[model samples]
Target: MAYERLYILVEGDDDKRFFEKILTPLFEGKYDQVKVWKYAQQKKEKVSQFLKSIKGMNADYIYVSDIDQEPCVTARKQYIQSKFKEIDKDRIIVVIREIESWYLAVLDDKSSKRLGIRYSNTTDNVTKEQFNDLIPRK
Candidate 1:
């Protein structure tokens, strides 16, 4: 039997929570179902391996990783596309930038400024802590 759910794989629990706290609401009841699989930072785990394992799950994936690798975004995207040629490129979003960027951008001005972040409807240097505080109840 099919899951009949829109599955999304994220890099970590934080990414999963972050997306749920924000984006999930936007998609509520908009589809048949919704789910998120968060990856753990295991010593032996490779991102490629993670991709391979989830490829057959027939779910959309969003890879939110730090741009610590060379030619980071392009490389990750190419690897995923080449490895899983059947998956839609748009369904696979490899964020070469840090996930903190997304979390910070969602905060209110007061919180952003308190974290020494300039939210001129633009950039920020806020960390995960600041993000958690913004969504304390969640």
Candidate 2:
């Protein structure tokens, strides 16, 4: 199916970049454009206004957020739904743990070795703190 346009609302730059680098290409011919919007970057007021601006535009949007501190995806989705009433409950994509793990999950062995970290196919267990620790400190 072809989409006139697809908007992906993500929590941070990493998620936006990920969608751009990976998802956008896959939708090359399927969508006229795949725009990744980092909702976190916008001021709360601006975001709300922006959502209102886009209302009734016949646009397709998918919201993505991290499962940070939330007990479950449902709760997170509920919270976001409350804030962004325009967002459909079923359209939110809550990243398991965080987006970092998803990136790590796809890293090749050479990339993992270059980063001086042992990688496993399942990166769901990798936390931001653990990944941060891998960075060389001056």
Candidate 3:
């Protein structure tokens, strides 16, 4: 089914920014509207409640979060499914280890140099703290 609108629920401001930068270009001309919601402060229960409330909306929904220390992406995704069974299985994306890994994947040598951070291929082991350290404070 082709969706005219896409609603993305992300874990934090960084996740929102990452989606804005990445998905916008990747999904350009595909969706008539794209909205990203930063729900970092909400607990898992609250997030599930919000998802339940948004059911039947005329839009495609996507939830993105870091896998953290989960056994694997499948486990993380299954955990989310256990809480929000209404959500489409394909729309839930759990980044391996952390969302910073995604950021790292896109960062080139030039960008890393400009940001004054060394480029490290540490996606599998990147932690929230390490991710935060790499991001330049505004």
Candidate 4:
């Protein structure tokens, strides 16, 4: 099935760069089937505002900020559902703890195993700075 578009709403530049670098390559052939666009906030974007922006854009999938602010899982989930009321719950994937997870996902298998983590995934309560050290800057 061809995916119309996948819109990922990130909080900042780091999240945008990290995801595109890691996830984009993995979905190489998918480019023909799906298009991923990154939407970043100019300021502190509230969930309500972010959702509204995405809704206006008519995205097929919405990956929104789920982590950060150290919010608990329940709070994050609830906020996501409530804020993005117009979005399809199935297509709306809340990326809980994005920074650390996106970074870990792209790490070599040996590195991920040594770190006890995987790309596109992360351990609970991991900090971005801690994960940042593991990923070399280009």
Candidate 5:
């Protein structure tokens, strides 16, 4: 399906930056524009407000959040679904552990070593604390 625009609501600035770097190139000619909004980890309230504000807007919405401390991915997905029942469940993505896990997965082995992180093919086992240590502070 063709979409006029794509709206991505993420947890924070880091997630926004990550998506812009990764998605912008892939979606450059697909949509008129792809906008990423940072909800600052304030999931439910911010999402509710965004949905209400864009009631009639012509755009595809994608909500991304980290499954932190949740029992499992299913439970996390259920929580997000309960918050915004109107949105399509397919658009909701609950990242395992955290977005940092995604970063680690995408980074090449050389890059991982440069960042002092042992390259792991699977990120599901990586903890947030371990990922935090590898990130260079600005």
Candidate 6:
């Protein structure tokens, strides 16, 4: 089913920015709106209310988080499930190393020029450290 609006729930501001700049382009022309919602600092009540509201709109949510300190993606998902109990298991995405890896993954030649970052074609096992290290110094 195609949702009119899609919400991507992520861990922090950088995740939000990455989704907005990188992932949103992939979703463009498909979803009417692709919202990258950073849920880290939101109050529990606000987060709960926002999730509840999705049911009333033509929207679906995907939960994305880094596999930080976890043994594996399954373990990380299990941990997140404890908090986001109401969400379906399939909606959760625990990045292999971290969301930063995705930022690197998207930095192909054209994207790098557009985003002003260096290109990277080999981010299969990369992490946040690489992402941070590649950040433009100005």
The best candidate by TM-score is: 2
Cα deviation in Å at residue 54, candidate 5? 3.1
- What tens digits encode model 6's per-residue C-alpha lDDT throughout 1-138? 664888998888788887888788998788888888888899867776777787567477888888888898888889877875666678888777777776667556998888777676777667777778777788
What lDDT tens digits, residue by residue, belong to model 2 across residues 103-137?
Answer: 78878899989987786878886777776677789
lDDT per residue as tens, model 4, 88-107: 55655556665665555556
Report the C-alpha lDDT of model 3 over 1-138, residue by residue, as the tens digit. Answer: 755777789988778888898886676578878888887787877777777765756567789878876788888888878977677778888877777677777778898888797877556677778878776788
Minimal lDDT window, size 10, model 6: 99-108
Show where candidate 2 strays beyond 4 Å: 1-3, 108-111, 135-138
lDDT of 1 at 106: 67
Model 1 RMSD vs true structure: 5.3
| Candidate 6 pairs with clashing backbones | none
Error of model 6, residue 107, in angstroms: 5.9
Candidate 2: 10-residue stretch with minimal lDDT: 50-59
Report lDDT per candidate.
0.61, 0.79, 0.78, 0.58, 0.78, 0.78
Clashes of 2: 0
Query: Scored by Cα lDDT, where does model 6 land?
Result: 0.78
Q: Give lDDT: candidate 2, residue 70.
A: 88
Provide the lDDT at 64 for model 6: 87
Which residue pairs collide, candidate 3? none
Tell me how many clashing residue pairs each candidate has: 0, 0, 0, 3, 0, 0
What ranking of all candidate models by TM-score puts the best one first?
Answer: 2, 5, 3, 6, 1, 4
* Candidate 2 lDDT: 0.79
Question: In candidate 3, how many Å is residue 107 off?
Answer: 3.2
The TM-scores of all predictions, comma-separated, are 0.58, 0.83, 0.78, 0.53, 0.79, 0.73
